[model samples]
Target: MFRGEHIGELVGNPGPARDAFPIEADTYERLDDEFYAGRIETLTASEQDLLLATAACTYPPLETADIRQRSAKSDGNINVLMGRLTEQGVLYRVQKGQYEYTAPKFHEHLIRRTGSLPR
Candidate 1:
């Protein structure tokens, strides 16, 4: 399920990557530069770790256990981190304990962005 009726809002202008299945690098760059950067700007290190953990999932829809396994920072404050991410529109609940990104390809974007970061 997409975020809205018009999918264009998320995947509209292909810019340069052109939606190449696994998602191209340029698309990630453009999306990060234009949209995700603003979204990521306000997150704490733990919250960003949560986002990366969610994106790195093998099957997705990460649960509390999954997050703990994936993130070293998934300590006592995990609930708080997840709650903050939800408040920021970075993630949404799919069920009682499962969560997914608010945007469809955002996880992929996170995965892509990870390779380019300083650490």
Candidate 2:
């Protein structure tokens, strides 16, 4: 959400420090798309898979059991990967064995990507 890659993508300019930055043409219609996609892109396959499974549920503090029921990645390291997501501020621990996303809209984004209606 806060990356300079925005200017690079939109401006298509690679000027030095002395170059003037564009004051307009600075908006993206799909800010949510850019923000969340960039965030998901930073994760490993394990992390992304876990996250997508969790997004299958409408509510949180999610459990590994929840993911187990929804995904083929039952043996994925839930603890370590969830902890890494927590460290990245993507998720927060609700208890010893449950976690939830920090960004609220991310759930909807995942749902749309996976084409899975909330259950």
| TM per prediction | 0.67, 0.65
- Tens digits of per-residue lDDT for model 2, 1-119: 53676565655445453254432223322644667788888999888887877767757567766766777654556767778899988988888777777886677778767878767
* Tens digit per residue, CA lDDT, model 1, 1-119: 43455456556665444556456666667888888777777788768777776655654676877777777773678888888889988888888778877776676677776753211
Question: What are the runs in model 1 whose C-alpha is more than 4 Å off?
Answer: 1-25, 116-119
Whole-model lDDT, candidate 1? 0.71
* Candidate 2: Cα lDDT at 14: 50
Clashing pairs in 1: none
Q: When superposed on Cα atoms, how far off is each prediction in RMSD?
A: 9.5, 11.3
